[model samples]
Target: MDKKKFPVLIKYCFLKGKNTVKAKTWLDAEFPDTARGKSTIKHSYTKLRCGEMNTEGGEHSGRPKEVVTDENIKKIHKMIATECVHHIIDEYLGMRKLCAKWVPHKLTFDQQ
Candidate 1:
């Protein structure tokens, strides 16, 4: 690559001091200014309704004194980002509906 292209390539690579690069940072680095400007998000609609998610990474350790571990926070982050809870709820609800429709209700156990 030419000297002029080195910086552009590096910028596209998302080199944030080291291998530790946030997904947002990587996206911003890869996308152009115009593209980034156009990528607007509506929190009311885009935000997934999940109350179990916590941003603080200091709640993972079992100890009552030690701050939360990084891995625990990462697990939550992955869960929220992938919307795993939503999928799980969807599956459970569908199964429940199917069960309600197919299964018959009985007031007396004599039929069993």
Candidate 2:
């Protein structure tokens, strides 16, 4: 049921000369709940045919995983505290709304 096993099984089927559909059927029979999709089996078969023998996935430029270490968490907390303090100071000093004007929520045509 492990994901890594799927590619290995698919590769075995390919090497055994089983076509994509047959490989999918075999996998379904073996792993009813966690069988890989037909397209996935076919893709793996194609890759095997193209000389990509590695059953594992290749390196891809995906979004980097967020590491939630204590150090990272502390850094994030420090940044958030600094930002909050800055916001509070700016608001108290009236520095954030210097070019603002008050208006009614529902404006009349003349006001607009």
Candidate 3:
């Protein structure tokens, strides 16, 4: 089960007056492979009881966040317009339109 489901289960068990032991047991039965520990259940229960269960996760800061804005979209559009797709493909992928043919010469042991 997902970590998100744990909070919902904890809330349910807490609402049903189930202790940590029973909650852990239920979790074990529900998801035998991923049975949540007592501490995890207790912490979630405490959060639910104390009305601090933030489903979206509490905010924390470290790395700068990146988001696409209208300015970025306009800049991308301008770049695409200035540099057409054919030139970009030819520059990177070496694809070009040409009219030509290969003429094979007679093979000889000396040529090899």
What local lDDT does model 3 show for residue 3? 73
Q: List per-candidate RMSD values in Å.
A: 17.9, 8.3, 11.8
lDDT tens per residue, model 1, 1-112:
2333433333333333322234235535655452222122112112222332222223465666645789888988888866765555545443222444532233248645
How far does residue 12 in candidate 3 sit from its true spot (Å)?
A: 0.9
Per-residue C-alpha lDDT of model 3 across residues 1-112, encoded as one tens digit per residue: 7776777777788889998999999889989987678898888887878887565566787755764788889999888876996566556655554455322233357745
Compute the lDDT of residue 29 as modeled in candidate 2.
94
lDDT of 2 by residue, 58-112 (tens): 7879766878789999999988876785566565543343337533445579967
Clashing pairs for predicted structure model 2, backbone only: none
| Clashing residue pairs found in predicted model 1 | 58-68, 59-68, 60-68
Relative to the unseen true structure, what is the Cα RMSD of model 3?
11.8
Off by over 4 Å in 3: 61-112
**23 Cα displacement, candidate 2 (Å):** 0.4
- Model 2 misplaced regions, further than 4 Å: 67-112
Best-matching candidate per lDDT:
2
